[model samples]
Target: MKKFLEVAEKLAHEKPLGPKYRNRRLVGNFKGRWECHIEPGWLLVYLKTDQEIIFERTGTHSDVFK
Candidate 1:
């Protein structure tokens, strides 16, 4: 999960404005939250605020959705 953290850190700074995070998008039914693929089946979910990025969840697709 180290790589996931590194990518999440980079995303916290760059957000949707950067090409590296092109796949990031807002999640349905979860206001202020966004989702991004970390690997084939792993995902990293977070909520962005004016001051900081708050991590909400991370896991395989099925595990995270649960």
Candidate 2:
């Protein structure tokens, strides 16, 4: 949790980190949103706008996707 927050903070301040963070744009109904892996099944979903980064969800794969 601590490490995830640290990385999330960095992502919010800087440009997308890269593959290490598993940052990728979501498709389908989730189009326009982006996601980053925190662990094996844990993920953080969010949207990046011109003014701010909006976090939409954070949880395990099942929980987040559902």
Candidate 3:
């Protein structure tokens, strides 16, 4: 989970992640949230506000979206 934490730290610091993370806003049931790839299929879902960042979930695409 080191990679996940690394990305979380970056988000916490407002640092831009590399393209590999594929960070982007989400829609549908997850509207207003953001998602990023941690590895091939693993993903991290979160929400960012002026006050703090809220992590919602982390898992493979199917695992998280299911």
Q: Which candidate is the best by lDDT?
A: 3
lDDT of 2 by residue, 1-66 (tens): 796887678877875566767889999989999899877678899998988888899988889998
In what order do the candidates fall by TM-score, top score first? 3, 2, 1
Every model's TM-score: 0.72, 0.85, 0.94
- Candidate 2 regions exceeding 4 Å error are none
lDDT of 3 by residue, 24-65 (tens): 999999999999999989999999999899999999898899
- Candidate 1 lDDT over 1-66, as tens digits, reads 787877777766774434544455665676568877777677777887778888888888788787
Assess candidate 3 and give its lDDT: 0.93
Q: Report the C-alpha displacement of residue 47, candidate 1, in angstroms.
A: 0.2
Ranking by lDDT: 3, 2, 1
Model 1 residue 60 lDDT score? 85
The residue ranges of model 3 lying beyond 4 angstroms of the native Cα positions read none
lDDT of 1 at 55: 80
Model 2 worst lDDT window (10 residues): 12-21
Model 1 Cα RMSD, 1 decimal: 2.6
Two-way lDDT contest, 1 vs 2, winner: 2
